[model samples]
Target: MNKHNSSHIYGIRSILEAIIAEQPINKIFLQKGLKGELFMELESAIRKNGISVSYVPIEKLNRLTRNNHQGAVAQISPVKFHVFETLIESVLASEKNPLFLLLDQVSDVRNFGAIIRTAECCGVHGIIIPKNGAAPVTDDTVKTSAGAAFTVPMAKVDHLKDALFYLQSSGIQVVAATEKAEDDIYAVDFNQPSAVIMGSEDKGISPSILNMVDYRAKLPLMGNIGSLNVSVACGVFLYEAVRQRINQI
Candidate 1:
């Protein structure tokens, strides 16, 4: 999908309000050299909040939003976010081995929503996504998930690689679900604290993240199709984990 058309907002006031509201503004474009109290206030807030910003010509901003944009535009997040640590802690406190799913760069909303629904049904503790590469949790995603978006806790990280590191440090086993692995996913014991990482349909997990993962496994396939849609792959892997975990009791 064209990145620009995904989701965006315009008008200095609207952009500022989105920032104030703590919406995940992917990037902002402001008319070149424009400055004012509100601009300065928004600038300060944007910098403090770590939102990416770029100064573009008025024509560029106009192209993004032809309405009375007032020289600024921003992209908004569709789902609420939670801190990863809090989710991990909550799972630990409950004596549940956390089952988390991390999306490397799955930008398709339907696939994302479908995965989330499967995750929730499999008792996944949370879903992790990168701040930039993943799809925005748009209304389409919520609808596709059948409102599972509201039930599932998702955490956005500045860098998914770093988040994997943090998860490892916190004692969660990171598993990369890719075709590269020789061992089957069923080979691993999933009852431990764990997180599964799935990649975009076009591209599998990023190499950097794959390197960090503790184990790499794949679902045995005999079909003519070389690959399964990301959402379908997620369901297979997560349900396998659920089956094993349930059987252990």
Candidate 2:
């Protein structure tokens, strides 16, 4: 694809190079029943890095790109993701009260974009997401974020639980936003180094993740609606942190 529409990279060699360079890739499509020395090398690389791949018919590859794909095509992410541990360490070292946002399988591109924008406004140091189920940073996501996707640092991990453990070890408290919590958002002490976890749009935070958080807090809902949209709730949660921090200053 052209630079303007460079969301995908075709051809086996090119895809392999992109992977080696650690480009943020959404998924790779490889022709089924095709094999060669270089192809074997590519497969080894993909497996070593744990990059997502799919085996498909040559016709499927052809449909993905008009170019000579050589039986490979990889969807690329617009934003370059940061290293999870490195990002946390850097933020903790620089900022006295580092704030983070953890997304638990938030699949909607628009919602993810809005959350990034809100996180940026709230001065969140970084955003963490799981590699598998989370939404890829597509052009639509970047547009919806109003370019905030480029501004805020983001990291994708094999698991959110691992990221949570790293954050807690680094002295940042993890907070989960869910209606199941008895404590409201206001009761949580956001003045400390904090990381807020927001769940997927449909199910809310998973029970597994909810149990791991340092604090479980919810928003006060006055209307008939039981809950706010994930992005809206995220905004409320983040701004509460922003509000508390501003008051401290």
Q: Rate the local accuracy (lDDT) of all candidates.
A: 0.84, 0.90
Per-residue lDDT tens digits for candidate 1, residues 125-229, read 889888766787877888899889989999888899888988899888999999999998989889899999999889899888888999999988998888888
Backbone collisions counted per model: 1, 0
Predicted structure 1: lDDT: 0.84
Query: Best by lDDT, which number?
Result: 2
Q: Candidate 2: what lDDT?
A: 0.90
Identify the leading candidate in terms of TM-score.
Answer: 2
Candidate 2 residues 1-249, lDDT tens each? 222147899888888888888888988899999899999998999988877788999999888889888888889999899999999989888899999999998999999999998888888899999888888898899999999999999998988888989888888899999999999999999989999999999998899888889999989999998989999999999999999999999
Q: For every model shown, what is its TM-score relative to the native structure?
A: 0.84, 0.91
Worst 10 residues of 2 by lDDT: 1-10
Which parts of model 1 have CA positions greater than 4 angstroms off?
Answer: 1-9, 24-48, 52-66
Tell me each candidate's RMSD, in Å, in order: 4.5, 2.3
